[model samples]
Target: VKTTVSVIKADIGSFPGHSRTHPKILEVAARRLKEVEGSILIDSYVTHCGDDLELIMTHTKGEDNEEIHKLAWDIFMECAGLAKEMKLYGAGQDLLGDAFSGNVKGMGPGVAEMEFEERGSDPILIFMADKTEPGAWNYFLYKIFADPFSTSGLVIDPSLHDGFTFEVHDVIEKRKILFNTPEESYSLLAYIGAPSRYVIKYVWKRDGTIGASTSTQRLNLMAGRYVGKDDPVMVIRAQSGFPAVGEVIDPFRTPILVAGWMRGSHHGPFMPVGVADANCTAFDGPPRVICLGFQVCNGKLIGPADMFDDPAFNRVRDQCCDLSSVLRAHGPFEPHRLSLEEMEYTTLPGVEKQFKDRWEDLPE
Candidate 1:
């Protein structure tokens, strides 16, 4: 059976500040999805990463299906309503539009979806992040799909020997390009290295089978303001022709620095954490990402194994803490804070305007 895995997420509200989602909001989302489980959805899982509420669903309906999108939008709307009642912070903040159109892509919420034939034991990983943009996934995607050092299967396993293709998106230009790996890896790196502009949107196997998909929506761009981080979500298939679950997740062991921390303007280490510990705290982030493993059988989702709940990842968590301290020490300096181009959506413009009249020309 061809099954579509859709992972949609939005920050409708959070308790106290932008640290975490309210339990009531999650409860409402669960209840609403449960209502349409057997009819509209084959299986559904509701989760949260920091303040972003994530809805993962398996269905026969293909990607970007209007019905599926509408169901998710309604659930978010209902949860946002309950959040407002509880007086939570930034209630309905991600619902950029007054009404849901045919789709939710441009409306606000981030979506990453892919449809494929279910293998004998279809294992998949859903990664949801908070306080970061879509570009945050670029580093790991390269390691997982292109670098043989990171994924030994690329060199050892015959099935993966042929390599994969990366679908990159220039979010600013609203264009996409495909590059086959091991052949154009250098060209690919030249673009993805500057992730704030070019983002890896999808990865496909040599046989044309889907390997991974990421939500590339830029929330700040869509809203034309500093509403918040994009808080992207991603889905990656594991085992068989694809990389093993271990290879897919091994890259995150090194906490790479990504943009999006406090006020969606600073750079911080991308820390991997379990769902229980996915809330933002220090510096309003350090930017947390949670991985949930699942098995799809006959269009149903089974076993959402929390991939980061192991003691093996404890060292990395400590490293992230150490890195966080170093970055925080920079305090408003470059490398810790984003560059001027990236600060376009933030309050930098207003601050620059305030001092515009006092500036004088420099000596020739």
Candidate 2:
């Protein structure tokens, strides 16, 4: 039997200034999802990453199922109302549309979906990040799937030696292209390297099996303005032909600088934190990523093992904190501050436009 895993998430509301989700909001969502538990959805799990509420569900309805999408849309709308009742900060923040049309894409919220035949032992990982844009996963995806250095499976595992194909999306232009790994990796890197523009939409093994996939819609781009960070969600299938569970997670051991810090204007290290600690407190960030692992058996999600809960990741968290401090010291400088192109959605562009004519052009 085929099962479709749909992970649709959004920051419908946040408390204490986008730091975390309110309990009442989550409770409302849980109740709504439970209402459709057995009939509409085969199984479901509701969780949060920072302030964004994640509704992970499994169904036989296939990808972009209208019924499933509307179910999630309705739940978020109800939760947004509850948040407003409680005066939650950034209430109804990620719901970019007043009404749900056909689907949730282009209406805000991050969505990663996949449909496949259930294997005997299916180990899947769900990665949800806060305070960062969708493109933040570009680097990690490349390293995990393409780089033999990060994923030893590329060198050792015969199944993965065949390499993978990556689907890259130009989020700004709404264009997409595919590149085969080991052969066209440099071509893929040339685009994804400029993560602010290009993002990895999904990946597949050479034989067409899904390797990994990410939610690629940027809320800012869709809104044509800054609503909030596009905080992304991803789903990766591990073991068998793909990388092992450990190989899939090893890229996060060293903090990598990603766009997003205070006010969504700075570059800071992306820290892998436990799901329980997935709060965006300091500078609204030092962008954080939380991972949950599950074993799917007969369309049921089991053991949402907090992947980063291990003590081994503690040192990396400390290192990220240290890096955050150093980067914060730079303040308004480049390499710390995102480039002017990336700052288009921020207030900097408008502020710079005001002084555009007042400033004199230098003559060399």
Best by lDDT: 1
Q: Which candidate is the best by TM-score?
A: 1
Q: Find the 10 residues in a row with the least total lDDT in model 2.
A: 219-228
**lDDT, residue 205, model 2:** 94
Candidate 1 lDDT score relative to the true structure: 0.93
User: Which 10 consecutive positions of candidate 1 have the poorest summed lDDT?
Assistant: 23-32
Residue 139 lDDT, candidate 1, scale 0-100:
93
Off by over 4 Å in 2: 360-364
* Model 1 TM-score, all chains together: 0.99
| Candidate 1 lDDT, 1-364, residue by residue in tens | 5999999899999987999999878888988888888899999999999999999998999999999999999988888888899899999999999788899999999999999999999999999999999999999999999999999999999999999999999999999999999999999999999989999999999788999999999988989987989999999999999999999999999989999999999999999999999999998998999999999998898989999988889989999999999999999998898999999988788899999999999999
lDDT of 2 by residue, 190-304 (tens): 9999888899999999989987889998777788877778889999999988889998999899888998777788899999999889999988987999999999887888979
